[model samples]
Target: MSSVSVNIASKVQLVLRVALILVIFGWILDIPGYFGKYYYTEQLLALVAGLAATITLTDPRWGRTPARATISLVLGLTVFIAFGYVSVRYPSLQLELASAPPGAVALGLLMVLGILEAARRQTGIFLPLLLLALVLFSMFIGPKLPDGFQTRELSFSRLSVYLALDTNALFSKILDIAAITVAPFIVFGFLLNAFGGSAVFSDLAAKLVGKYTGGPAKVSVVGSAAFGMVSGSAVANVVAVGSVSIPMMARAGYARHVAAAIEAVASTGGQLVPPIMGASAFLMAELLEMPYRDVALAAILPSLLFYAALMLAVDFEARRLKIGGTSDRLELPAQNSDAPDKHRWRYLIPVGILIYLLFFANRTAGSAGLWSAISIIAVHLIGPPAQIWHRLQDVWKGLLQSAAAISDIIILASAAGLIIGVLNLTGIAFQITLQMLAISGGDVGIMLLLTAGLSILLGLGMPTVGVYVLLATLAAPALIELGIQPIAAHMYVLYFGMVSMITPPIAIASFAAATVAAVSPWRTSFASLKVGAGVYLVPVAFVTQPELLLDGTLLETATALTRTLMGIGLLTLAAIGHMSRPIPLPVRIIAGLLAVANVLPVSALPQLGMAAVAACSLAILAWAAVPARTTPSLKHENT
Candidate 1:
């Protein structure tokens, strides 16, 4: 492309991004309602999808070569035309029933292909490849499969039209959640960070734990958790928090890979934290048809246990490696150099208002996010006059970044809708459920394990929202059918889906952190797995004993919480191979086994047996905390 064309494309891209943000914010704030010209959900979704696709294709980053640029521009234009046609004709198309017009059908095919390509450009090839495989199977191979797996075959045109135009396919509830509920929060997080909220979180975390052993790693955990409250992406969290924390940890005596792993695990757990979790949590509330607050409330104990386990593992590892606390006190970075004490309130007040709006005032998540974003702006405006222009520039950058981030999510959600549509159209969802049941042989444990594995597998190289959508569609049903509670089954998949961020063979988040730490990605990934081991088992505990999700009476909930925390602490000890002193391999094995036994469902054994198991686990833990007789222990190790 020539310089003139490049300038034109850049201008167009800017316009598209601004328009995308305005459209989403308009819908969120009901500006259309005020104007007496409300857009139907499908029409609005089509518009958003069109804008996202066009933006993705015209992005300079994706157009590295002339040929690729030409191809992307052509596809971008084609998608714009198709989505515009659908947006204008959606109402009439809805009335067409089984027969779509030839133009709609042709455009639908174009739209589907364009979306898949856009997704490939934005994310990676795995998701698009999987969606393509499913499309081909639905179109050709469905009826040829074995009796248990077969479904009525769909034609190419019919399938394409349905996926592109149907309410449940490309423009589904998942897309709605992404555009309306998630986009605002993404913007809120970006704005919060841009206005020094990240600095506030880091400074607060450092103050709280920087003098202790493994202080930098602990800061990563606390800061990431605070940042995760508003962030929806683990990789984003890693980049934002780990950029500061990783180097801090390395300076504080942690190995580069260990520092990266700590940041990766800490960042990934942010999605599991409450107030505001990942995009999937919003989708979960919608899927389960419960209030978002209820979902957050239920997530409390499990998220806490996850962080507790991570903190314990960090402490144990610090002791084992003989890493000590920083001698000098930590200070806020340069961007937040002005009156660092006051910077803390910039984040605290907005977050407090967000919590109040969500939990106390009964506001929708999107509304809470909008108000929180406004509060962030208000806080920044109140800062020193000389810095206002710089901060506003940061806010503008955040707006564009949020739009870009949201576009990626929009693509993923649309692709997910395509998958869900294929399943529903081919009647394969029921077949898969039956196949899972048959494979499990009516065993709930086996079914849970199968689901967990599949969740992790599908999650590789995918975002949490995309991972959860796949599992929720393909696996959660089977677990629910196996008599698991609806919330438990959904939360189970959500938890396992998150583990992939730290799991090897992909571990996208870990790899991102490794880049910052200048370490081997593989080493960082495996170390992250060790630090975040609790994530793998906590889901099981919640699934088996719902009290961990706060679904039981007070006593039952307390008992489950206490037992699971103990189990997590013991599991961390085993994984780290240290306590007061280095534990022998046999003792580590025993601790691991006892951790599992402690977290087993109360109903799995009689009351007396459960009590005995808990007692034994506690006794063993107490014994492990004592200093070894043969080896001299550092005083810090005994803390």
Candidate 2:
């Protein structure tokens, strides 16, 4: 704890961060032959980096005592490096490590414990506990379970080795995608943040929507979406944009809880945004063996509908409350300050290039991310710097941030691998699918509802990537088994997985935003649920009609898109209990039912019946939504 030890600990942490970043870059771009040629080596390196970073960043002991912190780092680094070197040097050991030899089992158990500890350190106990429960199930419970859930008996040694040394266990597809694809995008996002991209996004959003009703809230929506496109974490997005937008909304006459809810819900949707959606997108592409671009493209319509619904709610609320214009306390610094207009253009260049390469050139997401990052850094370096020292400091800070971001992703992905490994080993996913089908009586609707419930339960207290990975492995297959389109099924879970961030009882993004807005977390959470209501129905819409996912003819897609958008608008109006006028309770109930009916595919209901019902619903909504006459609409009781 002395000054000298404190300096040494700081230096060690910094060095570890830089090393982690370098390793990620080498693995992503294949600059070093060793990283690209050896998959296990890269995976081991990621594990080591993640553990070191987690201890340095999250462990409280590290801050309290320099000696303990240094010792922890040194020990973690040494064990990981030794294991990695041995694994790399002796490929045959991977198979042998799974055998029942005492030494091998001991090493495997230690590695498994290490991975769980790392996961616990970064995330909460939920995910690590889930994985541990699965391990226990496979060893003790699974073998005894009858019929559908039965599995072969395995001893502790074999189970430990299978999870630790087997390719499918600790280093599975989730880890693969995280390392190869998501890491680069994560780095790019933090890099963008480090170089004033937040200011640029805020300024641009304000200029675009600052004059409209609820302009500040709209800015939060637009800015959060833009930032979410690059970053995957809802909590991180809330922190980055909510700090600015929440206060802006509060200053513009929005209540504290409402402001917090708006930012939380808006930021939560960012993971669903395209180009660089949450890490789930990359994992989906990898699992489906399709291009990442395809996953992103399919997400476009739903994402648009999501933002449109949020914007509409904001507009309607602003009108209802008579709130408008920029706040006197909320001036945009990037626009008003000496920061040149041309400087803002710097933000667009990398984004433009990223889109061009991702969609037009058909480059891999990782490659696109690398080029985009290079473009961003290049522009910053080439531009005039007020001081060389300041530029160096900025670059240094960006590097450390990028390292931390990548490490979080690596750890989450690595931990998720255990879930995948256990399920595959026990064939539990298949058993669960069959059980679900049986319970639902082969009804697709019931099956979807069950799957969604499971998705939410499993996704809670986990990051978007971890949630999607777990659900995709266990729940998504059930939906697919029910004849749902593969993309639709995966996207269904993806939506719910990200939705957990704002879902009540444990909304991480809402908690973070509430802290920033200084509002009650519970109130902000419920408010966010209301703000995000329409989006909650999107997954069901896509499940019922695949056209909503762009999996149909042009005409079919357009018709579905239009109807779905209208359904979303109507549902949102009902949720808010306001349109042009306050809808009566009966009318709101009717509108809500109508919205669901409108979103349902004709196959679910007779085509003629659906059309008639939709028409009636639309007419009723339009009539009820018309503004009431102000003074003499109804005769007074006195009269």
TM-score winner: 1
Model 1 over residues 54-94: C-alpha lDDT tens digits? 99988877666666667777778788888888788888887
Candidate 2 collision pairs: none
Native-to-model Cα distance after best TM-score fit, residue 218 in candidate 2, in Å = 1.0
Each model's total of backbone clashes:
0, 0
* For model 2, the run of ten residues with the poorest summed lDDT: 328-337
Q: What is the C-alpha lDDT of each candidate?
A: 0.83, 0.76
Window of ten residues with lowest summed lDDT in model 1: 328-337
Q: What's the lDDT for residue 37 in model 2?
A: 60
TM for candidate 1 is 0.95
lDDT of 2 by residue, 220-304 (tens): 7888887777777788878877777787788778888988988888888888888888888889998898998899889998898
